[model samples]
Target chain A: MTGALIAGIAAGLLAAVLHFAFVQSYILLGEQYETGELVHFQTPADHATEDHAAADQHDHGSHEHGDEPSVLQRNALTVGFTVLLYVAYGMLLTAGFAIASQFGRKITATEGALWGLAGFVAFQMAPGMGLAPELPGSAAADLTARQIWWWSTVVATGGGLALLAYGRSILTVVAGIVLLALPHVIGAPLLDAYYGYAPTEVGAIFSSRVLGVGLAVWVVLGWLAGRQWDRGAAA
Target chain B: MTTTTQTKTQSLLAPILGMAVIGLTVLLAVGHAQSATLHDAAHDMRHATGFPCH
Candidate 1:
């Protein structure tokens, strides 16, 4: 357990570093697009007044509005919060690995990588099928509703995958598949029409890049957690 | 034997409880965080993990 905790912290730190280096820029870019500084596309009802205000701010080269944090402050908060979030994620991953190891599976780097991929699929890809990643200015459904759907999807997919992987009986496998499909069948809430400030291409790139980075982080996390756990068990 | 069983139960329960507490804290912290800070901190993650945010 101590080893797992240590590994989780290490992985979280590493993932935080990687996120700061690679993921931050894209998100900033998306924000820019969101605020209309780099408009690639616009709808007929696009808020010209808002765009003009943003343009004025851009021309003044000042973002120091009241309650607006400075770049330094923003980046600092980003780092702190990201580290906190990833540490929690890592701990959960480690705990999960510990539980799985109790079932007699060998915990190794390779298995860890697989587990990481499974995490990515369960948490990201499966939910993404219904609720694709959104940019800052995009339209979305009610927040509470989306959150409920997202959590349910994550839980069902994770549980389903575990059953499929470990269940010995056909009944279990079927149940797993049912759980996996349950979320999509219920469906994520959607807007009556597609509406977003950013271009489709930008949203596409953002989504793909986000997932790509996530995959990398999870893989590293799993590898380290598995290695540390194994070493601790041996000791 | 009873002591051993108690130890085993505690060992199992500790990590699970720890995880639940940590997870809930993180979720609440992010859920109610300041918009911009939350966006920057979790923007990539929210997208990467398929949590909808507009």
Candidate 2:
């Protein structure tokens, strides 16, 4: 247990580092678009002045001294937030791994990577199929409804994958498949029509890139956590 | 034997419980926290992961 916890912390930190290095810039870019700093699929002339005024207000509020946050401060906050979130993620992953290990499976880095991929599929890709990623100012369904759907999908997918991967009987596999499909069958709540301030293409790119980064982080997290757990067990 | 079985069960239960507690705390914090800082951090993450946020 101690080993698993330690492994989780380490993996979370590393995944945060990877996120900072590869994923943060895209997010920042999307935020800029979301907040109207940059315009796409629309003429700049339409909103240029309004955007600048908004930007000026934002700048004053966020960076009052006319000096932007130092690179160090920005990186620290990004890394700190990523680490905080990933640590929770890592702990859960590690715990799940522990449960799996009870079934006589040997924990290995490759297996960890596979588990990570499953996690990415369950938590991000599956929900994303319905919700997709949204930029800051994009239109969305009711928050309560979306959250409920997202959580249910994650639970169903995760549980389903676990059964599919480990279940010995055909019945179990079938049940797993059903659980996996049930969410989509019910479908996520959607607005009557698509509405958003950002361009569709920007949202698409943001969604895909976020998923890509999630995949990489999960793989690394799983590999490292598994290796650590195994080593701790051996010790 | 009963004691050993009970111990084993507890061992298995502990991690799952821990995960559930932590996961729910995060979900609540990210979804409904009153603090802007917590909300913003989680909001950024939601966007980062492509989870929908208006």
Candidate 3:
């Protein structure tokens, strides 16, 4: 029991860290497209029909946001909730592995990585081409929507295949996909008036690359998590 | 020794099943009672936590 708890904590931390890495990479890539003028920034400011005040307010707040929380921040509450999310996700995976192991099956970190890849291909890659939401930061970029979709699909499928080729299996792959999709299925308007139209190929491509990188990060994280869980059980 | 092994096994299974039951019950009740509200909150939480799925 002690071992399980320790393992759970370790897995949670590792996954969280990996998630941070993916976010940073996506952010950086987005900056590249913006600064390079590869994509035009389209804002409500550019359109006379939209509310400039709302757009300006949004931009100002985002640009001025601090890395550290304010004194009035619910730091403890945030940490507690974050920890709960991580531990719960970890526990679910660990339990799944444990159950699988009882069936004379063995899963390794590599297998976990493959599962992560599948998640990218199915949830991020496939949907991203047409279904994923574009980031506000990339709103003004000049890339076409179809281009973005295609690129995203290529990255997702290709990256997933690369991960699977390294000796992974079906279970983790499927689990990762399910994990990626669950929150989406449960939240946000499925059909938002904001992104009603299909994305251009360029937009899809850009989104795919970003998502591919994210998938890679997730695969590594999941593998590390699984390895840590196994170590805890043995210890 | 056999009885001891059985007791240990029972102890482990007990908590696992208990927690699972609790989780499932809450999940089902939430699903039936206020799915939209639950979804909205979960979505907001996921975004705040920087979950990449969205």
Each model's total of backbone clashes: 0, 1, 29
lDDT of candidate 3 over A76-163, digit per residue (tens): 3333333445444344344545545544456677765555455445434555534453532334222344334433443455444434
* iRMSD per prediction, in order: 2.9, 2.7, 8.2
Top-down lDDT ranking: 2, 1, 3
Off by over 4 Å in 1: A1-5, A20-22, A42-67, B1-7, B31-49
> Global lDDT of each model?
0.69, 0.70, 0.43
lDDT of 3 at A233: 55
Better of 2 and 3 by TM-score: 2
DockQ, candidate 3, vs. native dimer? 0.15
Top-scoring candidate (lDDT): 2
Worst 10 residues of 2 chain A by lDDT: A57-66
Error (Å) of candidate 3 at residue A204 is 5.4
Give residue B1's lDDT in candidate 2 (0 to 100).
100
Q: After superposition, how far is residue A227 of candidate 2 from its true place, in Å?
A: 1.0
Error of 2 at A176 (Å): 0.8
What is the C-alpha lDDT profile of model 1 across A1-235, one tens digit per residue? 5655566566666666766555555555556667766665456455453344344443442544466556566656655655566566666677777677667777787887777778778877888888887766667888778878888898999999989988999999999999999999999988889767766765676678667777787787778767877786687
Give the DockQ of candidate 2: 0.48
Docking class of 3: incorrect
Worst 10 residues of 1 chain B by lDDT: B41-50
- Going through the candidates in order, their DockQ values are 0.44, 0.48, 0.15
